[model samples]
Target: EAAAPRQSVVRRVAASSELVQNVAELAGIFSCLEEAFMVYSTRKAIAIDELMEGSRVSSVVEDVFYVLRKCARRAVATGDSDCACSVVNHVCAVLSQRLYVELEMRVGQIGRNKERTLDLTREAQYEGLMEALAEQWPMVEGSDDAVNTSSASALGASAMDLSTVSLGSAGPGGVDHSVLGDGSGGMSSTISAEAAFWCLSVNNVEAAADNVATVKATLEEEVRLVFDDELESAKLASCIAELDTVRNDFKKRLQTGMTKLCASLSPRLRSALGVMDGASAIVKYELTEAEFADNDGFNPFVHEFLGALERILAPHAAVLSPALFRTMVFKVAGYLAKQIK
Candidate 1:
């Protein structure tokens, strides 16, 4: 008797070039998923706190699942049962199990304030994604439904009927596949749709978070430089220049509807508004020759300058008003003078 065809191996003698290409595409899809995971891990390592604000975890979860859905669609198209089974198992395990765990860990770390913001952002993104997916996976209603009886059924069973599966009819909560091995196997639409929603949401939230960080950092840099003894002569000119530039940018953002981002820069705004009028007066505040000489000397070398400076400046950095900054300068000058004596 003739031996039955091997279900696990793709026979070169029997498989067409197009079928082979589809199998190769499945491998490529896995590579893409692995690479994306690597990128997500690296970014998380750099700053889990900040990235969580950006919705990095949710974004990666969505991206990996979406790609897996596409992989399943293409795998079924190849008409190779073994390849399709492998595709389904591999994609599902990576996206739903492994990727899900990694994402959960980061999501657990998000602060309550950021978590609320992320929830709102996700809802908006989900609606937009639902509309977009609607166009991609149009479903047709009919009385006849096509079914598969492949051995690949060992994989997760999807409610979606493989034979009748269209991109649109696949819906959002189940798996839809073109074909599978001798048993039965398929992709889950629910996971895929959920992932797509979160991925888009993360992109949106991350952009907004980054904008806030950027504005806060820029303002802090200028505010700190205001007290740099090196820049005493140019203090007024520099403070006005920097604050004016920031104000223009702030006004522009206000015009463009970035009120929330503007609000986030409250510390910067308070300092700028209070300092613009007082910087010149403080700069011109006359220092007595005795006051300067009383201090050990100008710019005396201190071995523990950084540590000591941080100890002195930590509290002040938080509430650095013009008067406060001036106080810090005189205090620091006196401390430095005492260090030598």
Candidate 2:
């Protein structure tokens, strides 16, 4: 008798080819997640505390889930065997289960003013918020055109059904076949709708997270070594001094990064705003897992996010030098370790 196919194994086999496009794509996604997490962790080394801004922090959280969701949708839709491989790359998933515990300590440091954050959290959200959102972002594409100020008349602000997407006969730039193993899996969607590109990062890439762990551990060790064993007491204080300077600098640049990210959204902000309306209900979120599973909209955000990040980084990279940006990873981890320790 022909052996019954193992869905897990079949899925794994299917995902392998899609991953062959460019290995860096996978790593880059993980690295972005790791960088976000490390920024959460190391407040001491590079001083990424400004990433604590509530809206900014929320955006980062949204970004993490978005990429993961995108990865998952492609994995399931295509039945890629390497699905779990992508899941494993998520540092957010791998962190200790009590991970939420860390949020308790950092909440105050990472958000907008308390009264404003509280006011924004009222049970009933306003329709004006939607209008504000629509006014900002009508439609966005990867190609850098001026941010569209037009509004979409797309009916209600309700949660959308994603399965309706059509992968018709190919049109220019609308769809392109990505390299994958054993061929036979290229369904293309019209480029007009909201979707992220499946470039080198998410499609055929594998990222490793252990390197980040090593970076964290080493920074901690170096910091600890400077002050004897009393991590708190140990302050040749030059490290602390540098960290303070770094944090201030990182904060300034992060604000700049956030502004760029925000400005870039002028074209896609409405979609994201619509996303915000449904976000609470659809994915009320679970302590155990994200609220909603990967729907079709998820896969495309990968492309959208890359476009957003590029715009955000472009304006701010000059304000923050490459060395500091690289060190931000270590500094964020350092700060977090200090906070919890």
Q: Pick the candidate with the highest lDDT.
A: 1
- Model 1 worst lDDT run, 10 consecutive residues: 140-149
Residue 206 CA displacement from its true place in model 1, Å:
20
Task: Provide the overall lDDT of each model, using Cα atoms, as 2-decimal numbers.
Answer: 0.34, 0.29
Error of 1 at 222 (Å): 58
Query: Worst 10-residue stretch by lDDT in candidate 2?
Result: 197-206
- How close to the true structure is residue 301 of candidate 2, measured as C-alpha lDDT? 36
RMSD of 2: 26.1
What is candidate 2's lDDT per residue for 1-341, written digit by digit as tens?
Answer: 24446766775676586655454465456445544554344322212111222111212233333343444233323322233233323333332222222222222222121232334322112122222222332321322221222223111112223222232322323332221111222322111111111110111011112222332344334444433434232332222233233224324434443333223223332332232235422232333334133433343333332222222222222222333333332343343345325
For candidate 1, what's the RMSD? 30.7
lDDT of 1 by residue, 1-341 (tens): 23444532445554567866786777567556654554454345323222122222224433443454455445434444444445444544443344434333322222112233345544454334434432342221111221121212110122222222222322232222211111112322221222222233323333323333343354334434433434332442333244334334323432232222122222222232221234321122355778566444322112122222322233222222233234434544454445434
Against the true structure, candidate 1 reaches a TM-score of 0.21
